[model samples]
Target: MTGIDPAVRHLTRTAAQMRKKKPMRIMLLAHSYWPEHSPPQRRWTTLIREFRKAGWDIDVVTPVAHFPQGRRRLPRSEAGTPFRGQRGPFGERIKRVPYLRHSGNRHAARLVDQVFSAAMSIPTALMWRKADVVIATAPSLPILVAGYLVARLRGVPLVVEMRDAWPDLARDARLVKGQVKSVVERVVEAIQRRADLVVTVTDGFAQTLRARGVKNVVTVTNGLDLEAVQLLEAPPAERDKLEVLYLGNHGESQRLDVIVKASALVGGDLMHLHMVGHGTRRPDLLKLAGALNAPVTFHPPLYGADLIARYRSADTCVVSLRDDWKSFETTIPSKTYEVLAIGRHMTAIVRGEAARIVTEAGGGDVVAWKPEAVAELWAELARDRGRLTAGLSGRDWVKANADFRQLAVQYMGHLSDLVVAGRSRP
Candidate 1:
């Protein structure tokens, strides 16, 4: 106490007091969980770790390990057996639900799998130990339904996390369309209205929801475990050809076709593009690249040290979304934050909020969504190698905005306030 800073001492005392209280319990509903390399899993894994340090209890209801490939690959112990609750490597408890076996890339099959698992999740969550709040994270939409039902029956505040700009994205993609308003849109908005809180990953989406009169929306954007992500070493000075890397989904929203075409337009001898991940559009992108003889390599996903090594190998990283879609105006790719944190130059093929963040960070330049434009930018970047080493501006932005430690604390406040207010209601 004598040598410690007063703030540190105060915090230590507060932490001790917090430990003495009954831990606030949370039941989270999701289509993915730990050991699965999905976006929701990554976001929640870091948050749950922080929650545990603060002495909170979390119970996760999820389907078995089946993502990208759409069938279980891990042993039951790691994936968790259906109807059995297993302790997570982090401090939370995970209750598994059965999933439908399907091909990873089949749309109808994936939808069926999501529906089956979501239905099973409702019962799994309802039978769990009591919780103060129930959180439903969407990437799998039916999980939102299960979350709402479970919260209502259990009589707790429901927090629906719309990770993407949903209903809007659905409309943009035309997943559902009617003469007036589709049933999908109605169902999503209804759930948003009924939920005690709506958590959006981007402030733009939060504002959008509020404009539509859903009053309880809050933005908790995707973030990094900064303490764990190192500032990557710069690319080699004597490189033969500049390498631009895109690591994440190879899906339509990315319009990766443009990227492949741009790489071909540059000619394989000048530069190379490495796209690492699985998605519905990956095979098509491969075919296009082959047809054009593009200098693009599509690799399966890399994680942990391998992912960092991939980042280290790149002179520039790409954070792209199709510019034609209005819903994307609010979408920020999770990897954008990662690229910024790791201190890489970017080719941000995005607009609105995502482009603004990149521009503000001074990490890189945003190019037009054209093959010739992208190819021209790459040529310019290649000619001026110095442009590829944007300094700590991006990292600084992440520290100020997207660090998970800070985000988790902000989220805890929201959960605590809701839990208190919820109990006080009639």
Candidate 2:
């Protein structure tokens, strides 16, 4: 017994051998990555950080960071190199591809950029070490095509992440003009069916995809790294007026005009809405605010302490999705979980899954999307400040349902199951 027990020695050897086994390798294709803090960046960055923590290797195939229009993040020297891999902060191997510069014609230009970048992604991904799986996330549809082709050529299982209600959204928005059945819808659906696993950000969308006969699907809702997100103290209720915040994009999908008109109705003397971030609609919103004389302050997008400062100064955060689009019912703004995690009351202008989340959290009221209804809610909140105390319900909701730590584990299990299943198939 004094001489090292044989069974204990055997167990130790087995443990060492397991540690020496190869870690899972994942090749991720997306429109954005680290150093660019957008919706996709936030979700994937947090998830990828957790994946790296688990000792998995992630290879990112993306184009030069030229998002948010009017701002190209990386310089020419740093960005446009094809087949040249750089290590990210999270240890991800970032392989950069060139992007197409656009004129004022944004929609058509951006599509061209996506197409160009997606084509480049193939060569970039193929040059990297072989991966066990290929994951392609989409709000940018062209990337899905690239992901499919790469996975096929490389002989790997493909995971297609539908971050938004794509084909439905395209039809709803009429992204393709003058056609009942557009090429865009057909391509998206074809890729969806062909993918090994279709992952949706909302359970509602996952259900929709399943109903459409997509074979394999899963739900991995957008979440934050709880430990990284600072929970600020709720604002004091003794103020003479209310301070409302809308910190995300100023896009058509948000229908921010309603929020502006609501603030106008609330009157500058009683309350003010702080609209932050930039988008195609910011200029129009500025003009609308000027015309209406709304008590709205527009700020360019802020990050780090600046962002947290704005959150601390707010009574409620606005999470909006246009109600007219049927597909939007299944969409949840990426900012929803962040607001909940940070314990802010929400003016949730949404329906369906997103509405259910806000109500369930007790952190906010799901108001009707109309300016009159939103204005009424604000007027009521201004009168009854006690309702502004969001309590810990929202934060609690995030911990249970939207924490990336838990969600990442779920993701790992999903990936493991898919990889194993792929290997097991004839």
Candidate 3:
């Protein structure tokens, strides 16, 4: 043992310490899981893989994969299996429950599906062996409720991971109003109160939860998976016409119609706008773009190598948010991180945290919904293409701060602390 290299010795000691205590079994409750192409699934999948590698026994409970497009993706043979258990990546066990499939881009329809999935997940979770800690990933309220119930029943600490602000986001988007908004706010508050720890994707979100009187909130911002980062090819050669890409969900919150309007403002032979992804608002956006004679081309979503290729092919990526919506101010779109990781220039049409990061990093220009301003920025970029390739401080910042391994370590430490504290209580 003494002959072992110092680094190896340190690693052995760390592994032994991790094994000194019985392996912690962590149950993750998420409405969407592996085989789904959504951001939340990607984030959790990477984290779960890391947790497993670190010797934690991680079990996942999720509905059959269906997201963004809202069509069930299970194999025909597995479609009828209401409650099926199978080994997932990294030796983690996964429980798939039946859920009502609905378009995730539509708020009301997605909420209905979430409720049904949550209902089915509760019983499935209760039947599982007790976990040391339960983590509920939520942009959906029902999943949080189910997680709370399972944690309570299992007598374990509950950790609520907020991917979005839920009721607050809905209310800001005007999707929930009047008495419905009041009720949702109350329910969200109640859910937060039940959580032994709250994990959020943004510091802004953590602050919002703290203001609502929820204690023990931690920010674990979305990060780039290093393995995926390594797979990205170098940015492709500049295209004949500057290809400006907007890749992500075309939901109401995204206010992608603003992009259409901006496209109309900048109609020229030298610029082309590519809008990729599916959403409830895609038809509306398409119709508006056609009516305005905007130079925008719409494409279905791409994943894996295809998506990375799309990024490489673009000179700039556009990210937008509804300017009037306060709830979105807290959001740092995962695409922003992706673009930075790929070292592509970006145009952030947003406010608050997202804008601050872009501005501070000098990643790209930040513009409002003003069509003229957006057009001006695009024209400027078109004239000075060098601006797109100049500074890479943003990419470097993300690589240094938002690496997945670093984020996973931070997340695991939080979970470990929570588990230890829970064990010490009573």
Candidate 4:
């Protein structure tokens, strides 16, 4: 409330009115939820609330979870546990399903988690009432299975939102091979083919789906929640020293070996590099930091009230993606949108949509994924401090166009079409 502009109040009210007519009974099913060190939950927090204000009833079905480390965290916020004292900004209902926690990067663990999630979810979906639409996200494909079953029982359309191109990710990551991968791949492939509509977060991913011959697919790129991002304002007391931040999962996909080497080249004391969040490669990165003698700090991911202030305080944020062919076409990491909103300059040692967005905004720099390139970019950023001041410019562009409210409007319209098509059937 403190930072919300009075002018936007009218727009919020208008969006709410349109939201009231044919309000959606949306059930978002995902493996990760709030407090899980994931961006989707935070985005969904704003998303669900906005739907509620617009007069829709929103419900979230997610696991009682922890992420990256696979540790189950306590639910201690005022909202309490989802089944009991759940409350938030927009008064949406939250339902938590029992799920097993395990590392996503390890092949054995991935199988275990996926199987367990699918098993637990089958019976768990019975706990909720039938909804108009069932929206499912993937990492563990069980949520899609859960949605399919629920949608079949309720006779509703199923929206499979693919956040990651799984089994593909597993294949790309070399987690499986030959007949084993083939059989599991077919299972996932069949799911995507059968979905009423398959939604992908990137155009590159959408192409992958089209090539596979799936119809009714759409691209809804992960976006900044403008209301939440705009609510963030610069903090008063930034240190004289530069604060370069790497926020989000630190995993193999980031090619952190170069990041660690670049940190060594920069000499940690001159600029502070803060890595926040947990991922498969965190321990290795920490070990690399020790060997390189870099000035780096690590912290757990922020949640609830802490998120806003962290953005306000960041001087510059960094995002890294490993150079790979499939990666370029398959993924747009969530941090890309978060850093854009922080109103800070961003540096990406990545290619694909992530770098394109940064360059188009004229906000930051993109370097080849190499140690020398990373070193050069860091040196360049260090020399041109004034350029950092303009980094927030991209954020302005995002506020006007790439906001979630606009995306939600488009998504709702798409859902209405699907609903109409369903009514016409047989």
Clashes of each: 0, 0, 0, 1
lDDT of 3 by residue, 343-419 (tens): 78888898899899888777888998777788788878777787787256776777666767668777877888899
Alpha-carbon lDDT of model 1: 0.88
Give Cα-based local distance difference scores for all models. 0.88, 0.87, 0.81, 0.71
Model 2 C-alpha lDDT per residue in residues 1-426, reported as the tens digit of each score: 369856446544543443354569999999887677778889898888878877889999988777766237577554546667788888888898888777423677888888999999998888888999999999899999999999999999999999999999888877777664477788899999999999999999999999999989999999888889988887897888899999988776898999999999999888999999977688899999999999999998899999999999999899999999999989989899999989888999999989998998887999998999999999999989888888899988887788887777778878878998898999
Query: Mind giving the per-residue lDDT tens digits that candidate 4 earns over 1-426?
Result: 568865356457656656657776887777776655466675566566556766777777766665555656564563134344254457766676555557555657756765676666556656677678888888667677887887777788899988776757767776668898787788778889899999888887788888988898998777877656553444233344556778777776676778778767877545677887777788888998998888788888776567666666666778887777475546777777767776667778777777788788765778788878777777666666665664467777676656787666667667767877887999
Please tell me which model should have the higher TM-score, number 2 or number 4. Answer: 2
- Among residues 3 or more apart in sequence or in different chains, the pairs in candidate 3 whose N, CA or C atoms overlap within 3 Å are none
Q: Evaluate model 3: give its TM-score.
A: 0.92
Candidate 4, residue 291: the lDDT equals: 81
lDDT of 4 at 330: 62
By how many angstroms RMSD does model 4 differ from the true structure? 4.1
Q: Please, what are the lDDT tens digits per residue for candidate 1 over residues 1-426? A: 699856446546655655565679999998998899989888999999988988999999999888879988988789889999799978699999999998888777998999999999988888778899999998678889999999999988999999999889988876655754477788889999999999999999999999999999889889998879999876766677879999998887898999899999998777999999999998899899999999998889999889988999999998889988899999999999999999999999999899999999897999999999999999888878878887788888888889887788778878887888877888
- Structure candidate 4, residue pairs in collision: 268-295
- Model 2 TM-score on a 0 to 1 scale: 0.93
**Alpha-carbon runs more than 4 Å astray in model 4:** 1-17, 76-89, 101-107, 230-242, 303-314
Candidate 4 whole-model C-alpha lDDT, 0 to 1: 0.71
Q: Which stretches of model 2 miss by more than 4 angstroms?
A: 1-22, 75-80, 103-105, 179-181
The TM-score ranking, best first, is 1, 2, 3, 4
Which is superior by lDDT, 3 or 4? 3
**Full candidate order by lDDT, most accurate first:** 1, 2, 3, 4
Angstrom error at residue 305, model 1: 2.0
